[model samples]
Target: MKLPLQALDPDLFARAQALLDDEWLAHDADLAPVLPTVLARGVGQDWHKAGTFRHHLIGVARSLALWQQPRAVRLLGLLHSVYGNAFVDLVKFDMATERGRLQALVGQGEEELVYLFCTASRREFTQKVLAGQIEPDGSLPLHTNQGEPITLAPDVVAAFLVVSMADTIEQWFSWQDDIYSRFPDTDTSRQQKVHWMASLWPGPMRPSGRMLHQINRLGLALQHPKLKGRLPMPPVFEACTAPFSASDDAAAASLYWSVIQQDQPLADLDVATGVLEQAVRLNPWVGEPQMVLAQLYLSAGRREDAARAAESALQAFCSWGNAWDKRVQWDAWIAWTRILLQGATTDGPGAWPERLDKLNNVALRAGA
Candidate 1:
């Protein structure tokens, strides 16, 4: 049968099939009967903004199998959304309604993993796991469907990591296929997923070092070949490198203070511009430094540089999504900068006052 993902990206579909065949899942006696049922459940359901739920299930299972995870872990990945987990709600099959049949098919161990993956509260899990809120004895506090606290066993935690990584990496590739069109809100959802994956490090319930390393490598390997240099480096892996050592806000602030405190003239602007450039390189998602650079270029009479910086700021803002206050601020800055560039090109600096007045009006209206 033609998989839904085959129409979206033939290369990826082939890769998934290759992995499944290599793992012998394509011919597994236990999985053969269950696979059709799982696919049928997801026949018309969408998964994220990419392919159907069946595609996601198969993709995640293929990823886990390729990673050489235990059979139970791979099975968990295949059925992770059976009970409607936080991020996905396609199947909505209740364990209480069909636990015996599932357990009989995949065994109790794999069935339990599926139930855990499906029922765990994502918000609570992220808060507890990412925030270093585990108990002193090293158990991570996770909640069951009843909202009661339960400690995850070390092996279970490890399995969870494998499933989570497989699920996230699959989704990441799907998003990358047509990022803007798939996600109209921009890359905000993608960014959140990357951040969550990145934050898994230096924690009690963190995945093993080997698993983390594999995840980093897998993330790098999944990038769209054409978007290699156009998009920022995958945030999960980039966080491990040197140049991204300092946060963008911190780096930008340090540069701003150094230049402003010295009251440097426009001739010395190169020094400040170098720092701003580095800041953007470190974290292109943040727009503050780009906007600041645009203002500096405008003051220095570099119309082209100012316009480019402003455009970069606009792109960054759009990528960050539309939080109301930030959207207003970015819209004002973008409008003002574009108007300044247009006026400079048509009438030279002689029209500065009139352009400034127009910008002021825009700011006032945005603020209001």
Candidate 2:
């Protein structure tokens, strides 16, 4: 029995296989000819989540697909993630520790080109870290000790931006759909997602705007021939995005600042609270409004209010993560939170805060 050729990447191969289920791997068929080019045309036909530090390689391929890459510079669009995962360590700023099989598939020029992509991707993460917008703790952290901030040429920035946008559009579904499938109808899972969102971020300045843009962009892309298979989403997504119009986001954003921002005061606490309530109703699933309101209470030095808000944030945290390069930052944040909590509560078995010896003695006596 002859097996059909397939792209090396497990995911691509699996998807290709599913697309041609009528044929078997043991018997080569029409899909045979399609597989080789699929593996050859792009970054190669494979990817590894752990090996590939970030989505930069995918971004690079996206750039190539959009004709952003010059002829000499482009080799395989599919080989995007091969470098970081197998050739280099984008996060560690080092060559990959393991060079098992992929080393032979891609040579020096191809590898060097991939390195350029990695460097460019690192620059993006670097800017975010320097701005204190993203925390560095993932496989995709700051790349090098470049004495100081590295300035990129304008063209590179444009290239990076295009790749970044395309990468995110692909990831929103690629990454999250996996989560949805795993925990389809779990309340606890949904609440955890909501909690995560609340704890992190300053809160949504424009939920409706974000959703509207995402939905519209996705719809537009689906109409294109290249993105045909990847375009459509579950019908429920429409219901999810029903209220994310520009007008709705603008109104919610206006209502939010009315209550939260010190620079702008439009009403009393009650009125501000009312605006938030309306905003929340406008987009209940989003975590930002709840967070902002909670933060507002805390800013006024309201301890209970702060706790309540923090609790809400925790409950709403999304476990699946997103493509805006947000997960690494949050993973860092959660680690800090764990350390702070342990230190604060470790006063020798006290009720939050008490004499260490006394608290220990009380516990000892209770046991007796």
List the candidate 2 regions with Cα displacement exceeding 4 Å: 1-212, 215-243, 257-260, 264-268, 296-368
RMSD of each: 16.8, 19.9
How well does model 1 score by local distance difference test?
A: 0.50
lDDT of 2 by residue, 1-368 (tens): 21111112334223322323323321333223323433353423234231132233433333233332343233333344344432234232234553323333455555454445554444344244223332222122333333334444333332333333334333332233232222113233556465565433333322223332343332332223332332222121232233245566446655654554543445545566556667655543333455555544433445454344433332222211122223333223323222222323234442222334542333211221
Report lDDT (CA) for all predictions: 0.50, 0.36
**Error in Å for residue 5 of model 1:** 29
Candidate that would win on TM-score: 1
In candidate 1 the C-alpha lDDT for residue 262 amounts to 56
Q: Per-residue lDDT for 65-152 in model 1, tens only?
A: 5454567876887788887765555654667788877888789888887888778765565445444454544345778756877777
Candidate 1 has which clashing residue pairs, if any? none
